[model samples]
Target: MFNLENLFGKSTRGRRLKSADRVSGALPFITAGETDQGISAFIGNDVKVFSANTTTIDMFGSAKYRNFKYGGDDHIAVVHTNKLPKYASVFVTSAIHKSSYNGQFNYGRNFYAKDADALDISLPVKDGKPDYEIMETIISAIHKLVIKDVVLYVEKKKKELNKLTENANAVKC
Candidate 1:
């Protein structure tokens, strides 16, 4: 049987379960005009740990929202829990807010339990046991790098779009 104590490095109930209490600084943001999609750095509902494998990579929200029949109405909203566990992935490259500007940043995964579970999580074992922290760090770094690259790409594209628009306006003038 898989025990939380062995996997999480802690045995307390709080450490093993996601408390019902609301997390501070966790504001809900909506994604619209698209299918329900989201990415979460946490795997289980207990505590959201920031890691590539642990993160949710699945589509979520109402299916109707994704279709244009409803005038492309309805949006998917993501709630960011501030109290992410210490083991949570720390994105040193770019904060979530900075990278997710205008929803251009893509985590390359759908934020959903089913999809998250489908990920191939390889835990690095040194002697005979897998190193949880090491694995978490590695995944976090991957996510950070990916998000950073995305941000840069989006910024570049936006600049190009702006330049073209400006040139077009200038031509008209």
Candidate 2:
């Protein structure tokens, strides 16, 4: 177990950007919402862009992994997991979610960068340190399993659709 800040480079809160002030464009504007990975809109406004491979914890303590550059509202805390490998960062994001998103932080007690810094998280350890290699391997294996399941489902759907097409043809004949 370790302080969340020690496991990463830095953690900071995002600046406030209002919906009405946003200009429409291609940059993702992340907010404190669970849907669409917390993206509220896309804008062209010049805002501080967070790096890829980072994690964002909302004021409500919902954590999300960000694989693309985005701008965030003040209600979000940016965790710089960009230094870690992609898979490892993903693992860290899950740990953050498990640690913080439990109805502990809400409207009255919102989560922030300081909250993230003080949060404790547990990771697989080896040689008295976090086993990032193991984390990467585990996440990679899970990704493979998920992909395999998706492919199998698509194949089954295709077969069923083909059977339906054949039945329709027989009815026409």
Candidate 3:
């Protein structure tokens, strides 16, 4: 069975679809759509520049929905390994906004890609090669553990809150 998550790494998974190609050195040009017909026209014209418009490179089940937004446009593109060449790297654009301090943006990780640009995360690398299978297993295990812990903690907190509410009501009476 094909694992969709495995195909798109967490770093490269959620990225906005822009009409820019690193090879061609082109940037995605944003245009306003007046109506549904105009939107269709934009897509039809962009299909040649972006493979997502015409070719279904990574049009796998559920993968189509697992993409990030580029700018304000909702046009999502499914990232696929096949479309990228051996030298290209996946670019992750993270916009972090916090109200505690002045609103500032920070990219947690800088442009992590698979090729030379790939970040040196604590992923299993044997003989200087990424052991993807081991990394995937580890990630999956940690994810499950975190979910279980969160659920248990929430349930415990709920019971405690209910007891406190009952005590407050009794005191008021």
Candidate 4:
């Protein structure tokens, strides 16, 4: 584990999206939450270059990997991991989640730019640098496990539903 500042540069300098400025168009409006998907609404006109693939972390320590150029509220802090290669930020995203400071952000504690910078996070390391390849492999494996669990849950529900339907039909016959 090491200080997050060692791995990343300063937070992305950007303005917070105002509710009053919202209009129907393109671009995403991000807000604070565990996983709002960095999308609150779609608007245009106030177009700015926040860029896609940026990572947003909320006060609650929940991190989201935004896949589009998005604007966000004041409560959210954007981490500039652009120096890293494409999808490399995914590992950083996971690291952000593993940070101890994550759960500390809440009603009493607000996670701001400075807080995010100072937080301690653990990363898959090699000869001192982040192990991107291992991170991708671990993330992929966890993804498959989640998918498998979901499939099993759906299958169980279908069986239960079918049994209920069968019993109802027998009574009606």
Candidate 5:
């Protein structure tokens, strides 16, 4: 186990952006909400743009993986996972979520960058170092399984729909 700051890199808090000042555009504006990966809106305002392959922890302690550049509000803490590979970063994001999103942080006690810095999480280690290779492999295998499940579900749904259509046609004949 290691502290989040040491495991990844520097952690920072985002600046505040009011909804009234937001202008619609292409840049994602991250907030404290869990829906849509915490994206409140897309805006053209010139806010500090965080890099890709990072993780954002909301004030409520919900962590989400970000694979695209985005701007965030003060209610979000940005974890610098850009140095790690995408799959490794994803693994770290999950670790962060499991460690932090426990209903401890709330409106009265919001999560922040300092909290993220102090957060401890367990990772796959090899020779006293995080095993990025293992993290990557694990995420890749999980991705394949998810895709396989989706494909099977689609096939089953298609067969059911075809049967319904055939029965309806026979009844109409």
Candidate 6:
């Protein structure tokens, strides 16, 4: 297990923006929520984190995987290191979920930077160290499975639609 401080460069709070300021703006102004992307609104470009592979853990224990360049209110934001792979970035978010202090955040306690820095995250061990390659492979496998299922479901729905159209044509004849 490694402390978050080593993995992430430093913790920084996101720019505070109220709901009124969340008009049709440019940047993705994110706040704490259940969403994976954590894009609550699109506001100004004041102090943004353009890094794609970053993780933003909210006060409510919601950890979002930032696949795109965005800005957010930092409850406990962590920028990915140069050595950290994209899949490992995802793994970090998942590991953040399994934190022992996560339960406390449920009762209105925020996941602040100080506590997050101390919290240890379990990793796939190889040679008694974090194995990033294993995490990537597992994610890749799951991605393939999910894509396959989605394709099959779409094909089935298309076939059903085609059958309905054929039935309608026959009725009109």
Q: Write the per-residue lDDT of candidate 2 for residues 94-168, one digit (tens) a residue.
A: 999999999989899999999999989889999999999999999999999999999999999999999999999
**In model 2, which runs have C-alpha deviations exceeding 4 angstroms?**
none
Best by lDDT: 5
**Cα RMSD (Å) between model 3 and the true structure?**
13.4
Clashing pairs in 4: none
Tens-digit per-residue lDDT, 73-116, candidate 3: 33222234333222111111100001111212123322112221
Q: Report residue 143 deviation for candidate 4 (angstroms).
A: 0.4
- Candidate order, TM-score descending: 2, 5, 6, 4, 3, 1
Backbone clashes counted, model 3: 0
RMSD of each: 13.8, 0.9, 13.4, 3.0, 0.9, 2.4
TM-score of each predicted structure versus truth: 0.34, 0.97, 0.35, 0.78, 0.97, 0.85
Better of 4 and 6 by lDDT: 4
Query: Which regions in candidate 6 have their CA more than 4 angstroms from the true location?
Result: 21-24, 35-37, 74-76, 79-83
- Candidates ranked by lDDT: 5, 2, 4, 6, 1, 3
Give the residue spans of candidate 5 off by over 4 A: none
Q: What residue pairs clash in candidate 3, if any at all?
A: none
Checking candidate 2 for backbone clashes, the offending pairs are none
lDDT of all the models against the reference?
0.33, 0.93, 0.31, 0.72, 0.94, 0.71
For model 2, state the Cα shift of residue 170 in Å: 1.3
Q: Give one digit per residue, the lDDT tens place, for model 5 in 1-173.
A: 98998876769977998999998999999999868878999999999999999999999999999999999999999999999999999999999999999999999999999999999998999999989999999999999999999999999999999999999999999
lDDT for predicted candidate 6 compared with the true structure = 0.71
For candidate 4, the per-residue lDDT at 91 reads: 73
Give the alpha carbon lDDT tens digit for every residue of 128-170 in model 6. Answer: 8778899989887888999999999999999999999999999
